[model samples]
Target chain A: MSSFEFTFWTIVGCGLVTWLSRIISFILLKKFRLPTSVIEFLSFVPIVIMSALWFESLFHQNLGHLPQVDVGNMLASLPAILTAILTKNLLWIVIIGILSLALIRLVI
Target chain B: MDDVLDARTGLKDTLPTVFGYIGIGLAFGIVGKASGLSPLLVALMSAITYGGSAQFVMVSMLVSHSTLLSIILAVFLVNARMILMSMTVAPYFRQERTWHVVLIGSLLTDETFALSMNKLNRTQNTLSFPWFNTANLTAYFTWIIASLIGALLGNFITDPKRFGLDFALVAMFIGLLYLQIIADQSMKKALQLTVVLVTCILMYIGLIFIPSNFLVLVVTLLSCGLGMVIKHVLF
Candidate 1:
C-alpha cells in the first residue's frame, strides 16, 4: 500500500480499536451479569492502570525502553507526590509539579 | 436546586481535570505536529481516538514508520484498561438506557472515571447522568480545542519541555491515584494499593525484555488480578 494509504488505514484502525475497548464492557455487561469477583477485580483497575501510566511517564525514556531515572522528572515528582499525599488536591499537585520541573530546568 | 447544585459541583470538580487535559492535549498537539502529522490530523485523532496516552504512542509510531498492525495493537493494548473502567462504571449506569450508557462509555477516560467514581462513592444521591455528562463534555471540549490551539501554535512553541509542561499528565495521574487511595482509607485498601504499585514497578522494570505495549496490558491484568486474590485471601 502507498504511504498515504498506510497512514489513513492506521488511523482508522486505531480509532476502531480504541472505540471498541471503551464500549466493549458496556456491551457485554448488558447481556451477561459480571461475576461478583470480576466486579471486585475491576474496581482495582483504575489504581493499577494509573500507576503504570505514572511510572511510564516519569521513568521511561521512549515508549518501551528500560526506565532510566531522569533527574528532572524525579525531582519534580518528589514535590508532586508530596503535594498529592498532603493536599490530595489534583490541581495543587499539577501546579507544584510543573513549577518544580520549571525550577529544576532553570537550575540545571 | 439540587440539579443545579450537582451540575455546578460537577463542573467545578472537573476544572482541575480540564486544566490538566488542556496542558497535556496541547503537548500532544505539539508532539503530533513535530512528528509530521498535519494540524487537522492531530485534531482529528484527538477527537476520534480521545485516548491521551494511546495517541502519544500513535504519533511516535507514525514518526518511526511502524506497521499498521503494530500501531493498532499498541493502541489497543494501551487502552485495554478502558474495558475494565467501562465495566466498573457499568453498575452505576444500570438504570440508564443503553444509548446513554454507550454515550457515557465512549466519553470515559482516566480523569472522568476517577471523578465519577469518587462522586458515586461519596454521595447518597443517585448517579446523576447529566452531572457526569457535564464533566465529560467539559473535558472533551477542552481536549479538542487545546489540540487545535497547540497545532496552530506548534510553529511558535518549538520546545514544550523547556517550560516543563510534559510532566502535567504524570502529575495529574499521581494526584488522582492519591485521591483514590485516601478515599478508600482502610489498612486492607492500603495493602491493596501497595500490591498494585509493586506489581506495576516490577512489570515496568521487566519492560527491558518484553515489548512495552504488551507489558502494559499484562501488568494491568496481573496487578488487578493480584489485588483481587489478596482481597479474597486476606480479607
Candidate 2:
C-alpha cells in the first residue's frame, strides 16, 4: 500500500481501539458492581500512577546504560517541590518548574 | 458561585497539561512531518487517535516501514494503560447518562486522568462534568494547534528540549503526586512514602527488563496491589 493509504488505515484503527480502551472498563463496570476492596484499591491508583510516571520521567535510560538520575530534572524539582509544599497549588508548581528548568538550561 | 468555581478550577488544573502538551505535541508534529506525513494528516492524527506516545510510535514505525497491522497493535499496547485508568475513574460517572459517560471515557488521557483524580478526591468524589470537559477540550485543542504549527514550521524549528519544555510534564507529575499524598489522610504518612519509594525502585528495575510500552501499566498494577495489601493489614 502507498504511504498515505498506510497512514490513513493505521490512524483509523488506532483511533477506534484507543477510544475502546478508554471506554471499555467503564462499560463493563456499569453492568456489574465493583467490590468494595477494588474501589478502595482504586483510591491508591492516582498516587501510584503519578509516582511511576514521575520516576520514568526523572530517570533517564539509554541503550546499555543503567538508569541515572536526571540532574536537570532533579535540580528543577527543588523549587517545584518547595512550591508544592508552600502553597499546594498546581499552577504555581508548574510555573516554578518550567521557569526553573529554563533558567537552569540558560545557565548550564 | 459553585459552578463558576468548578469551571475556573478545571481551567486552572489544566494549565500544566496545556504547557506540557504544547512541547510534546509540537515535537510529535515535527516527527510526523519528518516521517513524510502531510501537515494536515499529522493534525488529523492528533485529533483522531489523540494518544501522544502512540502517535509518536506510529510515526517511528512508519519510518521503519512497519505493516499497518503492527502499527495499530503497537498503538493499542502502548495505550492499554488507559483501560486501568478508565476503570479507576469509572465510579465517578455512575450517575451520569450513558452518553456523558462515553464522553468522559473518550476524553480521558494520562495527564487529565491524574489531574481529575486529584480534583475528585479533594471534592469528596464529586467533579463537575463541565469542569472535566473543559479540561479535556483545552488539552485537545492545544494539542491540535501545536501539532499543526509544528508541522507547518517543520524544518525551521529545531529540538523542543533546548528550552527544557520536556521537563514540564515531569514537574507536573511531581507536583500532582505530592498533592495526592497530602490530600489523602487515610494512609499513614510512612506507608505512603514507602509506596512511592518502592514503586520508583521497582519501575526502574522493570524498565531494565520490560519494554517501556508495558512497563508503566505493569508497575502501576503491582504497586497499587502492594499498597492495598499494606493498607489492609494496617488501619
Please give the CA lDDT of all the candidate structures.
0.78, 0.82
Question: DockQ of candidate 2?
Answer: 0.66
Return the lDDT, model 1, position B73.
89
Q: Cα lDDT for residue B40, model 1? A: 80
Candidate 2, B26-105: lDDT as tens digits: 88888888778999889989999999878888888878888878888999988988988999888777777887788878
Q: What is residue B228's positional error in candidate 1, in angstroms?
A: 2.1
lDDT of 2 at B139: 88
> Per-residue alpha-carbon lDDT of model 1 for A11-81, expressed as tens digits?
78898988888888877777789887887777777778778777766555454556677788878989999
State TM-scores per candidate: 0.89, 0.93
The model with the greatest DockQ is 2
Worst 10 residues of 1 chain B by lDDT: B1-10
TM-score (C-alpha, index-matched) for candidate 1: 0.89
Question: Each candidate's interface RMSD, rounded to one decimal?
Answer: 2.7, 1.9
Instruction: Write the residue-wise lDDT of candidate 2 on A1-108 in tens digits.
Output: 237877888888999999999999878877877898887777667888888888887776653557777888889989989999998877788888888988988887
